[model samples]
Target: MSSTPVRPATSRPGAARAAGWVAPLCWVAVLLDGFDLVVVGTVIPTLTQPEEFALTGTGATAVITIGLVGMMVGALTIGTLTDLVGRRKALIGAVAAFSLLTLLCAFAPNALVFGILRFLAGLGLGGCLPTAIAMVNEFTRSGRSGRATTTIMTGYHVGAVATAALAIVVIPSLGWRWMFVIGAAPALVLVPLMLARLPESASYLLAAGRRAEAEDVARRHGLELESPPDRAAARSGGAGAGGAAATVRSLFTDGHARNTLAIGVTSFMGLLLVYGLNNWLPTIMREAGYELGRSLAFLLVLNVGAVVGLLVAGAFADRVGSRLAGMIWFASGAVFLALLSVRLPTAGLYLMCFLTGCFVFSAQVLVYAFTSANNPPHVRATALGWSAGAGRIGAIVGPVITGALVTAGIAFPWGFYVFAVVGALGAVALSVTRAVRPAG
Candidate 1:
């Protein structure tokens, strides 16, 4: 019997440009998604005023939680679908769905109706990040994945920063509804570009037995084609498994259970800190004795720190291990978060806010780096999707907790301290997980 010829795992040079463009494009899409997701939080303070929207505290929290619930469902359902359909298609569909729903939010008659629209919008928003990350992961070369993913994620922060700034100017004159209107506009621009320029994942096509299409994509991007390998071998090479069942099974069988749980937990805590702060920072600052205008300015400053952190993390993680770098970052974040509870002088508070921003947000991206590195190709999408899906649960919880704290008359410093504790817990979880490296 003749053996099938084996292809060497050599680097393909032609994919560099394609890979470069793919990361930035995916980044922009996710950035817009992040902007819309957080804009509601930035506007909540205005919405809650009796003279403005007049929403009660608990009612407002309910609205935020409803959107999160929708996002959780969206992440799980759309994540699975990304495996069945292609990432590009799923992403385009998700963006369009959310875009229209956001427009609906602009016209919502009451708080309940607005909440429902936001939840539905959350469904589409939930799918965008994981799908975009998966696309970027597939396009990047080995050893460069962390940098590529983080670089792309910087767009997310940039979007948030832009939204906060825009909200300051626009919300004052145009009203909160205009924010949704503006949010919806990006989908119109992005959808067509994605359809025209976004290529399907080469690995997904190969797994689905569409070698011709896969090869065409690879050739267009300057990759060479090899015969598709068996399922197990393809998975081992990091060609992601396409089906839901197969992807889940891969996580448990190959010394991955521990790693999976670790990623889930770390992601949980990271997101808890992220959503808790992002959702309540402005409100919390207002309660902490800052004026409304200064509170919104703090939001911009926080995101500016986020952008700086994301830019630096990849280089540091590449030098050290991602796990180690993530642990240190989370630890620093915890420290800064706790310190925010104390009333620093004005300049000191701003400095601390910048420092906190630098580490807190990127710590979550490091979780993505860990997920991408731990799983092989076939199960990579599934692993990332599940991680993100789990993290969304924490995201849902963070805002609710902050809302409750505010309702209870807890000082903003105390609320910040609570967030700091979550960050500390995350640092601990990630530290333990780092000890056991998965076989790639």
Candidate 2:
């Protein structure tokens, strides 16, 4: 039924061509996840208009928090499932499921229905980040894990930035609902491409004892199989990854328990900053007396900084190690976040937002890079999943806390103070952990 010939290991160009697509495909999936991060924030201004959803700040928080709860569950479950089932299937299913649910969000009858759709859509969206991050890391050359993880994550902020820009044009003309429609449209193409072309991780295949399949995948992609020295342990750990419960247990039993707790706390604070700011910054700025369009621009500026931060942090982490980089970045984020409380001039505010964006988002991502560096292949997804899942709880709390502040009319400067403290906590968490070689 197919005319494609199997390329041999010597086919360098074919291998390069084959190996390169993985990052782009996974990037777009992450971009969609990025879109989710900002699309709600983009629309909140419009939704609060009396003619629109008439959403109070409290209602907005409820919808956003419920969605995050779904992501928490999805991250915990899908991250483990990806390890057990195979990255390819789990990713495809996640993209398709999220796309379909996002499309349904366009027609939600009221805030209640809209919130429900968001929760359902979040299940798939939550899985996308950990899955994409883990997939890209496995394919990367070693020592480049920081850059690889950060590079792929640019898609996330790219999506957020693009959504902010699109909202400016689309929301004024088409209405708030069109954002969801546009967001889901990419998945139609992304899913089919992933289905037809995306290769399974060779690591997963080998872990499952499908050596022939693993070797073929490795050979075609111009990758070497695990050498005998390290292969035994990778395989042994992977073998136990067969069941989700057992795989989770492996995380605690190895020297990983401390790293797990540390990563969990760091991820919690990291995501709390990420979701808190991205989802609520526009509202926060608006309450501080910025007009609607200017408030939206703050969202764009923040994520543009995120893109720059990812590029810089990735390279920086590679040089200094992820843990050390994370400490500096989180501490820096706290400084900038705390500085936002000062009533700066317009240009100064924009510059601070840009700088804040740079460190704040990447600070969380560095935690992910650290996680990838510390865990072995078999339990990597589970570790990433649980880490991200734990972060989702923070994501929920960030929005709810800010929304309550907004409701009380005290969100602006006080919100920044709370966020600054969270950033400090993250730095503290990472400071406690000494680096370890990845588990077998």
Pick the TM-score winner: 2
lDDT of 2 at 108: 85
| Angstrom error at residue 69, model 2 | 1.1
Regions of model 1 farther than 4 Å from truth = 1-19, 45-54, 224-228, 233-242, 282-294, 409-413, 434-440
The local lDDT score (0 to 100) that residue 438 gets in candidate 1 is 30
Number of backbone-clashing residue pairs for each candidate, in the order shown: 6, 0
Decoy 2 TM-score against native: 0.91
All candidates: CA RMSD in angstroms? Answer: 4.2, 4.7
Q: Estimate, for each residue in 122-163, the C-alpha lDDT of model 2 and write its tens digit.
A: 998888888888888878777888999999999998887788
Q: Please provide, for model 1 over 229-318, each residue's C-alpha lDDT reduced to its tens digit, 9 standing for 90 to 100.
A: 355534332323434665576667667777778888888888888888887776787788866434657777888898889879987877
The C-alpha lDDT values of all candidates are 0.76, 0.83
